[model samples]
Target chain A: MSKDAFSNHPITPEELPQVNSQSFTPLSNTYIKVNLMCRLVFWLMVVSALLIIYWQPWITLHKLLELYLPQVQLAAGGFGLLSSVYGILADKNKGYAIREHDFSYRSGVIFQSVVSQPILRIQHVELKHGPIDRHFGLASLEIFSAGGAMHTFAIPGLPEEKAREIRSYVLTHSDIAAND
Target chain B: MTSYQNQWLKLSPVAIVYFAVQFIKTIGNNLFYLLPAIFVGYNQFSENALIIISGLGALLVFVAISALLKFYFYQYRLSEGRVQIHSGVFQKTHIDLPFERIQNVRFEQPIFYRPTNHVCMLLDTAGSNKLEAKIIALPKNIAESLKQEILAYKTENTHEANDQEPQTNEEQLLNSRSMRDLVIHGLASNRIWIVLGALAPFFNSLSEKFVKGIESFGVDVDALMASSQYAFWQYVLFFFSIAFVVIALMALISILGSVITFYDFKLTRSDDRYIRRNGLFTRHEVVMKLSRLQMIALQQNWLDRALQRVNLKFEQLNANLERQSAGTSGGKIIVPSVTLEEAHNLATETWPNNQLSSINYNPVSKRLAIRNTLIAFWLFVPLAAVLTYFEKTELATASIAAFILSTAFIILSWKRRGYAIDDNFIYLRKGLIGVSYRCFPIHKVQQTTFSQSWFMRRFQLCSVKFVLASGGQTLPFINARIGEELIDSCLYQVEALKKSWM
Candidate 1:
């Protein structure tokens, strides 16, 4: 076997490029508004359903509703409000960094995580946007690796053009087999 | 290409039995959904034996015809170092697997094929976890030659062909398990618990039936218990004896299963490939290439630890996230009941620089124990309090006991969780009652993740996870600085080594 010259040499930690040294670029603020709007629509629909159920007479659930309907509504409203607040805080903390040979995404409000995927290992990259996201000019970039159905991580709420640029950059830098 | 290369090949006539078996397995797998229907129609069918008999006969006939049709439609061809298969009666599907993409070529000899001297060949590919192609009921000679042809093709197409010449292909016996060793491994492994778990839902009914059977034999168990013939201490002794007998019986069953599954187990190495051969009724042979191996896991449960033995598993690029049948998992070869020294020796033999025994493992932060205990208290204390308020003293006591046991387990596991790293390899040790030591080359990591909860961030501690082709391994609650340093070093090694993780 042909031995490489640097095979036996160990690279010290000081010589490596530290991930924490780089600053992360925050996501688009419009995603927070979109998330709030989605949450509002969902709670409104839930309230309407509850009202319809209460007005209906065919179902015998009226007896149970008469005792617990108010409490259930209050709980639902409280949960909705709490989740929206958490979502906004989480969105504010979400950020990503485009390193030379890898991409890093940092997220979570209470449980913070910084995930880095090597460009050489990425199988493919996808850009997706829901109706609400499109209306607010935002897109999400989904990165996939081999051996699993779920994406490695999806960096959400990027400007549409920035998402496209990142996708193309990943495609160009990664191996050709990634396109397949 | 060989002379048979471009011509369509049909399976032997005996493959009809194989297809019938496959059909039955498929039906059995989906039978859960049909259970309610069967119950609903039970009375109607039970009153008329003729209808039931006719229905079963028709079903058998249908199964026979479908198996025959499936065997007739299945055809495969070999051309230009690739295999193409055409199968399915109604769907008419096609599969193409190139020689290079094939990961392992395995052979199985079912009991039914013994009389005919035929073996079943399964081709495992890297593109998917499922078998790429299966040619059932092939003559032994033909299967051997086919395997040789594929291996030769793979060797020729490999990038490092010059170094991997035929002259260096010398087979060496690495390890073999005797009958005693196999029995010990069976006893030590946790498969007994798995078996009991599968039968747990029926335990109450099973015990009731046992009591009734004794009563039918004219043994008045309840009357004897009510009589003063047995003292309290004697009753306790009787209970202990029965428990011992049950445990012994279960252990015996587990041993029989282990012996049948891993009888005459042998591991052999030839150049860069490791071959494992085992099993009793259905002899199995699996081949693993060294280049594709991702990690090695040395697992020692409580019993295995007491016996000073460990079960070593060589993991590969297994896209199968779920457990599968023994032979077809494709990406792992398990060496059961090896000594601690032997396990380390084998690991070093594979990776050369993996000094597993000499490495110092740095334990994770103690804050892990506190956090886990807090989470457990948050989950269990409220339930225990409610039970106490409802005057369910027994249940409340049980809840508190469970909480204590879980808290102790968390603390013990936190003390054991550690990571050791060197220039070439990274090792992780973890478990509560048992321990699993996993190690891999630093360059094999495909991704690195650093996570910290609000509580952990307050203490400047974080968790780091290394994602590999096999799976992900996490080192929870470590210093934030060390986590960053580890990630930076791993990323550097991955980028600098320029090695293919596949």
Candidate 2:
């Protein structure tokens, strides 16, 4: 333990050590398009499922649909539009930076946060591509460390090739013995 | 060695009975929904003994056949430092578990298996996958020998000879809890609420039974109720007696549960591993390597503080998953009801050179007290108003009493919130009702976040959360400068440490 580092009182924020987020490059804007496509597919599936249930002969809900259909439609449309806009805006704030010793990710619009993980501490890296992502030729890279579930973070909307390259690079560079 | 030569081997014959019992239990659980139908049919067909007998016989035969088939198909082989299992009727599955990846191997011998000299062996693996390979009803000698072999292989591969202390030569008795200590632990554990919660579903029936029993005792309950003045006293006496009985029962249950779970508790250190052995009926032995330890928590409730005792709990990797699946209460190694001094000693022993007593704790902002009190007041005032509206003066009085108690509780909790960080470790102490002192190695912190809301910004306060392999620890309403400093230092340490976390 370093005794000299101990202080009776807290230092001012100006005097505190800083981790500069400005050094990290912003994420590619293509992620917003990918997110929109995925959301569209999700909403389409949800609407179709509702329509199928409504059209079913066994369901007597059709009688009440006349009273609620317009309201439900309006609500669904509004939600879809709001989510799309939020997705585009949120994408602008999402960014990740890879450094020699560690990687840092900056996220959130309302309550911004920056999280950094040392490269040696990374347990594993996963490349995930959903149906929509595959169609858009985009992939999300998930990085997991030996800590809590919350320690894991994902960077979405990377080109599939870029995602694969990053995954391979992380796997090769991270401390292999630490994972065991 | 001869057993190892065998390509594949079946479990002991005793496994047939084990499989049959397991099959029956599974069927019973899955067929719970059909219980009503079965009961109704049995009532209607009571006169037809032949039909019932035939049906039961068919089911018995089916169970026997399936158990036999399962036993026949299940085979395990040990080869090339790996244990391989093959099973399944239609879709055959093969699982290969390497000895190097095995985190822990456990052996259990139930009373039924005693005569047969068979034991169940379970191999646990680390990571989120939580894979457990079980070999049911193997010969006790074979299981023991296999466990030794696997452990020997793991030790040899995981640690170098120069870096590792010889196991048997360095074995030391760390601590043991006595029966008296366990009793205090049970009383002070705060598990009475859990016991009461479990019994909540039967509260109505139990109360009804009590009233009926009282009625049978020839008490004029209706006459008592008819007189308003006398009824008040009688009701108070009745409720007091009920509360007394419930508390007594809960105390007895908690004490018994603690005694049973922690009987003859012992923690021993050998080489770089800590071995815990305890339990009354079913003795359990859990071994964890020091390298795999994620956090150590020292806990003391209000009652424990009065008793001058604290519990030291060591959490290893995947401890949460183990607790969830095994349903083992207090799954971590808990040196139950040790004196505060002894708890500190144990913690220092586990993490050498880190004197817990010397670290200075920095308290959170005092403004937390006002915030919490206001929140509690807002939450309770409306309920009190509603009770007053309903003209339940007695209940309203009780609610106000509760309100005052909760306010005091919040203030006490606020007073207890503080955190300290040294070069090697960070210590966080916080909780309500019970105070917990959590210490995590600074280098092991996977992630750190410092966030400040607009309101917090005005006060120069922020909440810092540190993510460890085991879980996350948060220090709320702390000086923003301190939070930022801790985060930066933790990140620096994470990058600097050359040693592996696991």
Candidate 3:
């Protein structure tokens, strides 16, 4: 009932123990969009956005005037630039991240968050391609976490072969019957 | 209509006739309607000539007839591996749903459905949304036999723990309910909803009468406020009079609605799941796995708080959908009349490992109090100004001031509600009299985010939102430090090697 109850007995948030002990089974070789395919796809979304503005000037011009867009061209350019700068700076945040122990990914700007999961949780992995990705022989790898925000993660564009490889690795290690 | 192969399976012919008579009186209320139609057809609005008169009569007759037949043609049988339900009038349907796929089966033999040895049964799971897939009226004996076979099958095939697609769903339906539970829930939980239903007619009349003079269209709340001062206290007294009459008129309607909704509520447990069934003439059954339940929500309002009652709602997973689930909800709730202590016991019993905490002790930020007070003033400014200028009444101004002051007090109280986050749990409380609460295990958190706007940053405040598995808990903006701390706890949960279902 008093304010002191908080500071007097605060709950501590500590780092999880990570050692090879107990009945823990080490998850197999599946980088959560860590492979080259994801990085490539991520680049492709940015490139496509840029390309559309260059190719379809009228729509862009209309959008620019109506103030319908969230951020201005300058702001978009800034966020895009910031994201790229962050990507380059992402290695510091790399660790283990997974949806359902199926596929794990780790990347961060100032702070690193790594998630890992077992193969059973990897309901499905999808490789999506846009016109630009198709032309560039690149694809984006999206890993479905099955539940919550972990349901899907995007690695913009990767080489087709690498995407297929990651998907295969996840499927082999995981035991999710395809609903289809 | 699908021919009831066993035509003798019809619900009591006598009871059916009796209910039909009630139905006819309720729907055929316009028997003299025909006499008026011929007389008034060319005398009034031609645009709605049919719709306002003959069309409505025909529609009511059609609905009443359909209600009668839907009651009449309803029949079922239990075969070797599945059950059959034959219903509908012009268009016919004969379903042969296998026993293995039937998630959980429940039967309701209401006083009426019972007399004919007939019962309404619901066969549900996460698979389909067909209307009949959830609610099907079947012969009581056939329904019992079907349930027995399914239970026997579930017992025989208990091999895999994660048998995602089992040939048979193992959950059971609430078969027994005491009359006391119904009466308690009816009296305790549903008064406000009933009140709103009762006030509908009065609201329509009051809104049109007060507002029509001003905007003459769309609910111009401004006009209504302006009109309120016309008779001063006298006009306001008339409004209360209107409300009183509306309350009386709505009381019966509200009671009937409650009776229909919670007619035969029964809660049953099978294996590791809880199932609930309720509804009078139109029975409904919902089955949920114990582990699949995501979060339990405790809601109290001014009325409930005074009565020491809390409405319990459960947020379930997609896998736990009933045949006729509410409002695109992936959540299932048991809204019973319970005290704070009882609610806590029920919540803990349902989730033993759940790390739940009460509202943490803290003084709210002065800035939060100030901002809310200012916001409340902003909201009522137009009303305040209008009354001050046109009505030139001191009571009006005092009333507005009192409203603003009371709102400020609530804001101050809400700030005191505070928030607390332990390593594996987060708890929040809000509101005045009712004091709602929500708790969750961090590991079950989907994602958590910390966001701040320019204004929030200026106030040195930010919000940390935890997206839990249930879609139930909503994170409130607290002091910035606590928000960050909550996020850290969730992060810790995600990274923990030994994960407990949060």
DockQ for the candidates, in order: 0.58, 0.38, 0.10
lDDT (C-alpha) at residue A45 in model 1: 81
Predicted candidate 2 versus true structure: per-residue lDDT over A1-180, tens digit per residue:
223455455545455346653465666767787677778777777666766765668857756785786577667767887887887787887887777667777776656677777778777788888887787788988888777565787777788998898887777774543444
Query: Each candidate's fnat, in order?
Result: 0.70, 0.53, 0.08
Residue lDDT tens for model 3, B1-502: 1333333355445435444555667656766667657566656656767668887788768766767786677665555555666766778787767666665555544555655666655665432446335334456666555555665564455545554443344545433434554444455455646568666778777677666655655666666557755668877787899878866555555455556676656666666667676777645555565655666778876656667767677666434344224311224656565667767766776766554435454544566666676777776766678787787688667858876677867675666465565655566666665566777666665545455555766666765555445543544446766655555555545543224232
lDDT score for residue B83 of model 2 = 89
In model 1, which regions exceed 4 Å deviation?
A1-11, A54-61, A135-137, A174-180, B27-62, B127-131, B152-155, B158-164, B167-169, B326-328, B380-396
Report the candidate with higher TM-score, 1 versus 2: 1
- DockQ leaderboard ranking: 1, 2, 3
Model 3 residue A110 distance off true place after TM-score fit, in angstroms: 15
What Cα-based lDDT does every candidate model obtain?
Answer: 0.84, 0.77, 0.56
Residue pairs clashing, model 2: A147-B469
Residue B314, model 3: Cα distance from true site in angstroms: 2.9
| 10 residues in a row with least lDDT, candidate 3 chain B | B321-330
What is the C-alpha local distance difference test score of candidate 1? Answer: 0.84
Alpha-carbon runs more than 4 Å astray in model 2: A1-17, A33-88, A148-150, A174-180, B1-6, B27-69, B88-93, B114-118, B128-130, B139-142, B158-171, B212-235, B319-322, B325-331, B367-407
> Candidate 3, after superposition: displacement of residue A108 in Å?
12
Every model: iRMSD: 2.2, 3.1, 7.7
Q: Between prediction 1 and prediction 3, which has the larger TM-score?
A: 1
Candidate 2, residue B193: how far the Cα is off, in Å = 1.9
